[model samples]
Target: MKLISWNVNGLRACVNKGFNEYFAEEDADIFCLQETKLQEGQISLDHGEKYRQYWNYAVKKGYSGTAVFTKKEPLSVSIGIEGVEETEGRVITLEYEGFYLVNAYSPNARRDLSRLAYRLEWEDRFRAHLKRLDKQKPVVICGDLNVAHQEIDLKNPKSNNGNSGFTLEERGKMTELLASGFIDSFRHLHPDTKDVYSWWSYMPKVRERNVGWRIDYFLVSERLAPAIADARIECAVMGSDHCPVVLELNGF
Candidate 1:
């Protein structure tokens, strides 16, 4: 099975930039999106009839949201995690016969770190949610997690240290998640690959110079690591500040 995850930044704006063309060419079995920034009836997407669309929209207008277009029908679909009232529509869980696929857009800590506390709390709850799903079956979690996780995850690590996404607190939470029986697919496959990134800053020539962070990911239960066929960062495909990250598995 093939799964692709991307943070479109804004779905409507991305469509104008050729999102549909890339989507068709990829032909992914499951395509997950983050930061859609729209509500129901705001825009229309004709992803063909084979894919089943699921969306989670935020209460705020043109704010954080997520969507999933899957070729396979999920046995059940749910939004948000248990015990957490997610007003921003950040998470969507689709239960398939073999696994639970979770698409999440983690809350950013903001440039001034104003939301650091809330972001940490959200991480704790999100980790707990994933653990709960893992207890039932292997889980495949993907999207823009909003953290660099380690010094190696971002370019110019010394300069980015303590920044919102690279802070010790945020990075520790990611470490804790991986320790809790999950494997970051990309890192698992290419432990020492460098200069590769998924999200880039909009600063002049930043992306051209490849100054970016590997913030988006496809993480799966540790047991599923053996089934991972390929994991990659599609940096060339552009519509947003972030690009798509892909994961292919041997068995459904």
Candidate 2:
């Protein structure tokens, strides 16, 4: 099975940039999106009748949100983490016969670090949620995690060491998550690959120069690691500041 995850930055704006065309071409078993930045009834996507659409929209208009398009219907679908009052529509989960697929748009710690504490708290809750799912079945977690996990994940790590996404605290939280029985699919596949990234700054020349961060990911339960056929970044595709990350799994 093939799955693709991308943080479109804004789904409406991305659609104008050929999202539909790309979506049709990929024809993945499941396609997930983050940071949709739209409320209900803002836009419509025609993915053909083969796909089932599931959306979790934020209460605030034109803000954070997520969606999933899958060829196969799941056994059950869930919105947000249990016990958490998530108003930003940051997460959605689909329970298939074989696994639990989680689509998450993690909260970004603002540049000033004012939201860092809240972001950390959210991470803890998110990790706990994943752990609970893992106990039931293997989990496929994907989206813009909003952190560049390690020094190898972003360009100029030295200069951006203390920045919001690259900070020690954020990186540590990612480490803790991975240690809790999850594998970062791309990094697990290409251990030493560098300069490849999923997200780039919109500043002038940033994307052109390939100065970016691999904040988006597809993480699976440790036991599913053997089924990982391929994990890659589609850096050449363009529409949003972020590109798509693809994962191929064998034996379902």
Candidate 3:
């Protein structure tokens, strides 16, 4: 099975920048999106009739949101994380016959780190939520997780250290998640690959120079590692500050 995850930044704006063309060209089995930044009835997407769409819109209009478009219909679909009142519409879980697919847009700590405390708390709950799903079946979690994870994950880590996404707290949570039973698919497959990134700053020459972070990911249960056929960063694709990440699995 092939899956793609991208942080569109804003779906409407991205569409104008040729999102549809890229979507059709990739033709992934499942395409997950983050930071949709729209509510219902805001915009309609013509992705053909073959794909089924699922959206989670935030209570706040034009804010944080997520969506999934899949060629295969899931057995069940759910919104939000367990035991949490999710007002931001950051998570969507689709239950398939073989595994659970979770699309999440994790909260950013903000430029001033004002939301760091809340972000940390959210990480704890999110981890718990994933663990619960893993107990039932292997899980495929993907999206813009909003963390750089390690030094190799971002360009100029020394300069970015303690920044919102690269802080020790944020990276530690990611480490904890992987330790619990998940595998970061891209890093697992290309452990030494450098100068590859998914999200970039809008600053002049940032993206051009490849000064960015691998904040987006496709993490699978450790047992599913053997099924991983490919995991890649689609850095060339454009529409938003972030590009798409692709994952391919075999015998799913």
lDDT, candidate 1, 1-252, per-residue tens: 999999999999999999999999999999999999999998988876989999999989999999999999999999999878979999999999999999999999999999999999999999999999999999999999999987788998999889999999999999999999999999999999999999998999999999999999999999999999999999999999999999999988
Where is model 1 more than 4 Å wrong at Cα? none
Each prediction's whole-model lDDT (CA): 0.95, 0.95, 0.95
Clashes of each: 0, 0, 0
Cα displacement (angstroms), candidate 3, residue 71, comes to 1.0
Rank the candidate models, highest lDDT first. Answer: 1, 2, 3
Q: In candidate 3, how many clashes are counted? A: 0
Clashing residue pairs, candidate 1? none
Candidate 1 minimal-lDDT segment of 10 residues: 42-51
The 10 consecutive residues of candidate 2 with the worst lDDT sum are 39-48
Cα shift from native, residue 161, model 2 (Å): 0.6
